[model samples]
Target: MHILILGAAGMVGAKLLQRLARDGQLGGKTITKATLHDVVEPTAPEGCPFPVEAHASDFARPGEAERLIAGRPDVIFHLAAIVSGEAEADFEKGDRINLDGTRMLFDAIRRIEGYTPRVVFTSSIAVFGAPFPEAIGDEFFTTPLTSYGTQKAIGELLLADYTRRGFMDGVGIRLPTICVRPGRPNKAASGFFSNIIREPLNGQEAVLPVSEDVMHWHASPRSAVGFLIHAATIDGERIGPRRNLTMPGVAVTVAEQIEALRRVAGEGVVARIRREPDPTIQRIVAGWPRRFDAKRAEGLGFKAEAGFEEIIRIHIDDELGGRFVA
Candidate 1:
């Protein structure tokens, strides 16, 4: 089996590549090739048993999507997108990359002759609008609040339609905000969520962009990678024509996250966090869903971190060598 990962340089994409390379197989078949594509060339994973190809290409650019799809990979992980903050800030770039790029990729796959790959698209919980119910269910209607959310919701619709037409087998996993992400903060509005814990653990000061009571959905990087792998391997027949499902994750408030930090790194480290609420972030977060029912994903065998404490532990072990307070 051949696997292709777009947005291969992003945090989730990079982690997924490592996971796939380590396994070297999917759906009981040995991986013959792994292709990683992004605007910038992705760093090739070390010790990959199969051939790994890293290419720099923009899917929205002319002929780029077709060229990348030429290999007819059995599994395509479309994890590429401009993040929430950046997308909300830059209208044109976001539309080009998030909305247009997705269409091009799906269209390219649809035109392929006798080729039907399993497209595991990484959607976001942002698909739910502001005025959300206490817990959003599988049947909840999509009413995106941000341009980024709108684009993701649009992508889900396209995936379902494409799958319905028998062009490809699509599984759109609406990911929760991945916490304890391994790396420096980017421009995402949700970056502060990880920063509060990540920075303090590293003995650095981090900002709190919203009130402590602000709640939201979360999952670990490990679980996010697991979702991609499972979506690729799971029986799509059970998924039926829906093609999109909200992934299960822990629901926690910012106060709970701080408590987890205090538990792990002690109160002193947690004290390093400074609170300077930004109303823009508050408004943006206000429209986001705080929790999800995610019954469909759970039934389909997807799992998430038990709690914020476990999430922090995963971060410390995976990225901090299980030691802090230096």
Candidate 2:
């Protein structure tokens, strides 16, 4: 099987690339070729078993998506996007890259004759809006408040409609806020979710922009990669016309996360965290769903991290060599 990954340089994309390279197969089929594409050229991971190609192409550019789709990959992981804060800050760029770019990719695939790739789209919890009823279920209506959320919601709709029309096999996995994300924080309003854990582990000060009682959904980077892999390999027949499904994740508050940190690294490490409320961030985060009843995704064989402790442990093991300073 030939695979293509867009946004191949970001955290989740990089993790997916490493996982694919190490395994060298998907759904029990050997990967013969893998192509990585992003706005900037993505560096190929060393010692990839399959033939790997890296391309720098903007999906919004005319003819770019068509050119990329010409190879007719067996599976495509569409992960490129502008994060929440950046999207809200720059509306035009967000719409151009997040919405128009995704549409171009779908249209490009539709134009392909006798080619139906299994598309695994990495959606976001941002698709759901504020005033959530405790836990959001699959039946809940999407009313995104941010431009990024709006774009992902629209993409989900397109995926379902195109799949219903028999144009492609698509699975849109609505991802949770990935916790303990490796490397420096990006523009996402949820960056604090990772910062509070990641920074303290490295013996650095990290800011908590929201209150300790503030709760939100979360998953590990490992689980995010798992979701993408499952989406690529799972039986599309069972997915039916509904191409989108909410992924399951842990529901925890900042206090619970701090407690987990104290359990693992003691009060000294936990003390590194500083609480400084940002109302802008609080408002944006308040509009995000705190929990989900992802029954459909769970029943469909998608799994998530057991809890916040496990999520943090996975981050330490995978990204920090399993070492934490007391």
Off by over 4 Å in 1: none
TM-scores for all predictions: 0.96, 0.98
User: Candidate 2 residues 123-187, lDDT tens each?
Assistant: 88888888789999999999988889999999999999888887888999999988888898665
TM-score of 1: 0.96
lDDT string, candidate 1, 1-326, tens digits: 99899999988999998888888888789999988899899986889889988898778996788988898999999999988878988989999999999999999998887888999999998888868889998999999888999999999999999999988899999999999877897657788999988888888899998999999899999999999999999998999999899999999999999998788779888988999999999987787899999999999999999899999999999888888763
* Candidate 2 lDDT for residue 112: 78
Best by TM-score: 2
* Candidate 1: residue 32 lDDT (0-100): 97
Give RMSD to native, each candidate.
1.3, 1.1
Evaluated at residue 191, the lDDT of candidate 2 is 89
Single out the weakest 10-residue window by summed lDDT for candidate 1: 181-190
Q: Clashing pairs in model 2?
A: none
